[model samples]
Target: MDSDTFVYTTYIRTTPEELWKALTDPGLTRRYWGVAFETDWSPGAPMVWEEGGRRTADPGQVVLAAEPGRLLSYTWHTFTPAWADAVGLGHEVYEGLAAEPRSRVDFAIEPSGDTVRLTVTHGGLAPDGTIKELIGEGWPAIVSSLKSLLETGEELPEPPR
Candidate 1:
């Protein structure tokens, strides 16, 4: 895998619809992943994330054209005033939501036995060391938390041991 891309797969003892809602619903995502997704979930809709003092997906952000379920694509980051005024080509330490450019999130759900396997692929990130490393480390914890939430109906106090 390229340093810019990180792939994570998790098996949850749940149905596809359950997994889909868990992945798509912003409320559910916030509980498990600690990020809030804001979008109408329609094709050509802007999916934005508001965290800290910065808000992603402003001017020049990609708009989702169609969002049925399981797949979400949005212009992740555009040249914000802060980013544009920054000295370097990039300002954010990481990419995706901020920092470097290029961002998209693809989530797929498949059936396995009585459980659903969720595969999350985040790509289009700037090919940088920090972005790659952070995604690699962050994905596992998020995936594990999702798995625990689905199985036990509660967030795990700690990442899977």
Candidate 2:
């Protein structure tokens, strides 16, 4: 693992516009990501994350950049008490992980012939980086689900916890 960066890239057989909508539209995201982002999607916009009856708008999380059908970036979610409880993390472990520098994820979209190339780069992970492992396992599943949804009108099974 690169101590400060983690990256995942995938190609989807879809138009860049469709992929961008899948990533930014809350209704579409809910089908694949289980969490939907609420934001105007302009650079520096605040983002609200919602899932499992909880809504989190941690000060640390916000839209870093947004370019329709091309790129989007945002700070990682904060481990708020409600989020910790939803994810079954106790206060101590959550605090320890949350106290570290918040990470940021960049989504890059590129059109290649008939498909879009999507690259996810997560940066600023903690030295020990407990979140890296979780993200490592989670990103593939999430992206795969997104691809399936776009191509087959079906989502992949829920990512394993």
Candidate 3:
């Protein structure tokens, strides 16, 4: 458990190929997380993020690795004013996030007999940064919803604001 990184592991009753589709397919992602990423899923490909009708794109927002059903990693989205406003983040909080160095998230998938082990690692965060705090509460819910969607063909209801 590194202070500057967030790691989450879960086992889902699905094939590696299906799990990979859930992670990369915009439709699947939008179902679990109200976010859609537009990219070719190749290393160095730029990613355009669409969330709540707001689009965020940056040169640094790129895929670092893509191994189909094995591994996928990419730089996190840029914290722009529009994104913050759309998500109801205040000006001060948005400024604080924009000031921090961009972080990267990696999704590793492995076959464990009848289930697939998915490990999500979000790294390069400030030890005590606001992003870390927010993601700490955010990723679990998102991952749980993802698991539900994959296993039961339905996503969990959105959490209250």
Best by lDDT: 3
Q: Which parts of model 2 have CA positions greater than 4 angstroms off?
A: none
Question: How does candidate 3 fare on TM-score?
Answer: 0.97
What are the per-residue Cα lDDT tens digits for candidate 1 across 1-161?
45666678878899888887877677778778765667776666666765433556664554454344355455554545554344243444424335566566677777799987777787877666555666678778888888888889886565442
Question: Which candidate do you rate higher for lDDT, 2 or 3?
Answer: 3
What are the TM-scores, per candidate, against the unseen true structure?
A: 0.72, 0.94, 0.97
lDDT of each: 0.66, 0.89, 0.95
Name the 10 consecutive residues with the lowest summed lDDT in model 1.
Answer: 87-96
Following a full C-alpha superposition, what root-mean-square deviation does model 2 have from the true structure? 1.3
Clashes of each: 7, 0, 0
Residue pairs whose backbone atoms clash in candidate 1: 43-64, 43-65, 43-66, 44-64, 44-65, 62-75, 92-99
Best by TM-score: 3
lDDT by residue (tens digit), candidate 2, 19-137:
99999999999999999998899888889999986888877789999999999999998778778887888888788777778899999999988889999999999756778877888
Model 3 ranges with Cα > 4 A deviation: none
Clashes of 2: 0
